[model samples]
Target: MNMSVPFSLLFTLIILFLSVLISSTSAKKPGDASQDLVRSSCVHASYPNICLRSLSSYSGPANTPGEVAQAAVKVSLSRARKASNYLANLRSQSKREQGAFHDCVEQMGDSVDELSKTLSELKHLRSGSFRWQMSNAETWVSAALTNEDTCLDGFKEVTGKVRSDVKRKVTNLARVTSNALYLINRLDQSRQKTP
Candidate 1:
């Protein structure tokens, strides 16, 4: 006959098995609660805008006020001129590329003409408006976006750049002008205060 198991040994084994199970369960790590939280990291460091800091800190050249104005106007006019040049180039190319379905490009070319003309007007308008344009640069930015939308309409893959470039130049000019005018006003206020 088989010998019966010792009661004390069986109890010891049961207790050992229970202790292992309890230890394993207690040792489980809690996952971090914040791991599930969505965090969008910073897209860009907040830089002070309008190149003011850049201009202010600029020790490379002692830029005169009129020199600054001249430089800015030159930059703006150059952009307008480039936009005009792009339209001219596109017009020339469209003249060469006209075909069956492609014949519609002539109309697009005409649309480009319209857009270019508006851009030119805006370019000149920006010059005159530079004294006090855009009560809010953000609102000005929104308007530029509208201008972008208008430019993008009926545009093919090609002029997407032309449209975007036009918007960028125009917007940049507006920003520069705002900064210059603000500087001017500040200077005038300081002069009044001193004298």
Candidate 2:
């Protein structure tokens, strides 16, 4: 009876151990794969937190490096468009900073155009033409980033609520653009590695 009890107890312990191990392993595999993908992609970003936050929401569909890059570009394009609209609204309300607001609006418009070009270039990114496409995208995105900086620079001479508001919008747009550029570079590197 003692021997049977000990065997039963050991059998139960073994089963429990196996169950725990299986559950732990299974639980980690899916989440780890997604997290690893996000971490690895974000590793190449200038703003990893922005990259992670922007891309993690689309982790399910953006499993590959290219997909992640595309998602980042889309996010960047959306941000730029929104910033452009906000700047336009602020430009209309500006009385003291009217000249500054006009210049900033023009810069924001240019930034939006550059971002659009980046998105268009990314769409043409294939393995065969990866270099050319990525180069175009990098150039356009860099220009967009520069334009955002220029917009902020224009605001340097102005003071008040309009300057602050436009600066905030442009800064956020610049961060998103920077994130997109990093992801694009990552995608290019990943493509180069493939056989």
TM, every model: 0.31, 0.85
Q: After best superposition, candidate 2 residue 99: deviation in angstroms?
A: 2.1
C-alpha-based local distance difference test score of model 1: 0.38
Measured with C-alpha atoms, the lDDT of residue 28 in candidate 2 is: 66
Q: Which lDDT tens digits does candidate 1 get at residues 1-195?
A: 999889999999999999999998776443211111101100111222443433433333223333332333333334434543554455323533323114333433443343343334323425345444323322333343344344434344434454455456445544543443343333334334653
Q: Kindly give the stretch of ten consecutive residues in candidate 1 with the minimal lDDT sum.
A: 36-45
The global C-alpha lDDT for each of the candidates, from Candidate 1 onward, is: 0.38, 0.80
Top-TM-score structure, candidate number: 2
Clashes of 2: 0
Backbone clash pairs for candidate 1 read none
Candidate 2 local lDDT, 1-195, one digit each (tens): 454568788999999999999988777655567668878888767888888888777634576777777788788878888887777776344554777777777887888888888878776767678799888888888898898898898778787676788888788879988988888887877777878
lDDT of 2 at 90: 61
- Residue pairs clashing, model 2: none
